[model samples]
Target: MLATPPPYPSTIVTSTNHPEPPQITIKPVDRRRILASLAATITPFFSPHYPHLNSDQFPHIPVSFLPVANARGLFQMPPVRLSNRYFLVRAGESEFESLGIINTNPVAKTSVDNGLSTIGKKQTVKAALRLKEMGACDNSCWIWPSITQRAYQAAEIIAAVNGVNRSNIVPEYSFLDARGLGAYEGKALQSVSEIYASDLVSPDIKPPPINDGTPNESVADVFVRVTQLMSILETQYSEDTVIIVSPDSDNLTILQAGLVGLDLRRHSELAFEPGEVRFFDPSSIPTYKQPASALYKCPNPPSCK
Candidate 1:
């Protein structure tokens, strides 16, 4: 039998407009103990069958075949965790013709009216309602920091539509924010594409040059950060579901990384429209060498294709 998890530290704070702020509970795991148990159980299962299999035919033996200490060490490493289900949603569209341009352009201005258009808000609400109908609202919601205003607003709408309190919404910075576009910000979508034509067309990963006086992050940087975050989330919420709201380009990058295990250079192959939503199982993500084509084979909207 599994031991009971220790009570996690939780606190409640009151807001001026609302009686209470959203509640956040964090449960810490005993990594060493878990790894030890896993190694012990897995070793015995594989030990009896090893001699029956041909090592020459199967060059990559299971981790369980390793010594107990080695197995434990491998299990204890980072970026490995039990699988968890998650939902990814793109933020509603703003005035920008294409994604990322507005964020990259320092001169561009954003306000309640211009940031999320009326149609964008409606689409987000509809997407949230669809999730709620599908029982996804039971899980906590996480939104990207850059699009907090619109993302949180959509979360609030979701909570209201689901007849649940809005305390489950949280903000995360792991999602690639538009500011990473640097000099591309504020420029027309076509102009930005023209500037980075070589980078976009090249089969190899070629990160765009950083513009002066702007924060710049490459596709690889975002991939690494998001993958680390996925490892942590899977471990912490192994049996629970969660939602993530982010921008289109950022969402596509994450989806491509998770579904195909492709390098950052292939990020353009996958795309997402504003307010689009998709389901994913973080634990089952395969490596690039083991491509899972079926996961990403579904038809997409015109923009996504």
Candidate 2:
């Protein structure tokens, strides 16, 4: 009479034996993060072992001085060549003062006689300017005067013109003597009839003759002394250099010697004018003139000893 009831079979439920599934939690990612971050940064620099441009490149620059017409590989110019160490300025003329010894009348020893004239001053300025034009001012330079005021004044003008500091000028007296030159100082061929003379000494004083001639320096003394000065300069500067002044033709002689590797022919005196300067070649030298009186050097002649 009533609805049929469904059958409930399979298994009976027990409360103590049944278990529930475990839950898992997850965190959300924030667009704006509050967490601290550690970021590493790097910077760059030049290496310490890099080479300098000037040192790496200067050797490739063309040599400023070229060879002369007569001499091969020797450099000579009116204006001196530029260099890092030295620039040589050859001063002509006798110094206005002497080293305690007077060559002229005592009355002629006044300041006017001892100093540079207006023309001489101008010449000195011109010489310096010429050197600058030739590029001698890139490094330290010197103004060297013979032991005389005239040379000193000329040197001063040159220093001022060349922009050389006063401290760079030095006084050198080595060219003043004839042990450096001896009896040849003031003697002159006063008359056209006068001939060149020599200071012949007794055989006792003269050294025995050698292939290069008796030990008397002849003109070689000037060459040796000049070479010595230049050697000193080479050590100090390692560049072309100028020695501002010297007495008579001493500076010229030295320069000529250094360039030619031989003695200079002293045809005339080197006079002072401020603007006047001479340049010499260091590599090529002239040959020395043999004197008629010089005895044959050796029995063997040793291949042009």
Candidate 3:
């Protein structure tokens, strides 16, 4: 249903990039869950409401709630449609950014070194206040932020302002992480242009690896992951408002390009600044600018890169 959609509304906010996934931690199994599962099975078998029902179907195989159709054909994805309105927020400036250094390395994502600075915090707070003013929080909403310290900190500020529950503030690891700079780890902030230069040449290009501290990423690589994130969100939610917080601009820009049906190579032109917020129409066409074959890769990205 999306066709030549209108430009999204952009408001001041606070944002960064990609590369590595956060370390995973497994949680201990809950005994209560096991008992609950057993009770569901036993009660269903004995309840008068279903006295003759098949016990073999004890654990119901939840049928797909979404309608199925072949109109789009087998390899083609449905239109870029979302049940809720999404507001994209770029995280505020970080401590390293304040020093003119670029820090998208996942190893330091949680370190205070990559966290927000005074100006950045102010930016995030202002953006959150703006969202509150917009009535986005009148009903329940969810905030999804990159795992980076800066992005998560911004999420916290929004939650505090809107009174959103901490449980709804989710940390996005794969799709929303700052773009990794690989060997460019401690380089000057302006060095990001060097990476984007390669990206324009081909989305498959990667930044040089000094030693894989944080491998670099190609625009195409980011396109794939962000597309995955969109797929998940579109399928799981509806009639809701989801705030996407990123520590850098590249990921969000790439996402916007995909949303608006622009060429992937043109993504840099859509650069968004830190603490900026924007909204796009989900019914837009061409959700992802997928190519015919594999080309560039990622391991990176920096905002504006």
Q: Which structure among the candidates has the greatest TM-score?
A: 3
In model 2, the Cα lDDT at residue 282 comes to: 35
Q: Candidate 2, residues 82-186: lDDT per residue as tens digits?
A: 232334443423243222232222223233555555555655667667777776655656666665555666677677877778888777756522222222223
Provide the TM-score for each candidate, comma-separated.
0.56, 0.45, 0.69
lDDT of 3 by residue, 1-305 (tens): 77873343323222225545444445567888776655555554544355544437545622222122223222223343556788889999999999999777788899988899999999999889988987777798889999999999999999999899999998888789888777888899999888878877877787877664786777888888788887777656667889999999999888888777677777888888889877766666555556645655544555332
Ordering by lDDT: 3, 1, 2
Predicted structure 3: clash tally: 30
User: What's the ranking of the predictions by TM-score, best on top?
Assistant: 3, 1, 2
What is candidate 1's TM-score against the reference?
Answer: 0.56
Superpose all Cα atoms of candidate 2 onto the true structure and report the RMSD in Å to 1 decimal. 25.6
For residue 72, model 1's alpha carbon misses the true position, in angstroms, by 10
lDDT of 3 at 261: 69
Candidate 2 wrong stretches, greater than 4 Å: 1-112, 176-218, 263-275, 282-305
> For each predicted model, how many residue pairs clash, with residues at least 3 apart or on different chains?
3, 22, 30
Output the better candidate (1/2) by TM-score: 1
Tens-place lDDT digits, model 1, residues 11-79: 556676776765767778899867755665455445534434444454455545554322222221122
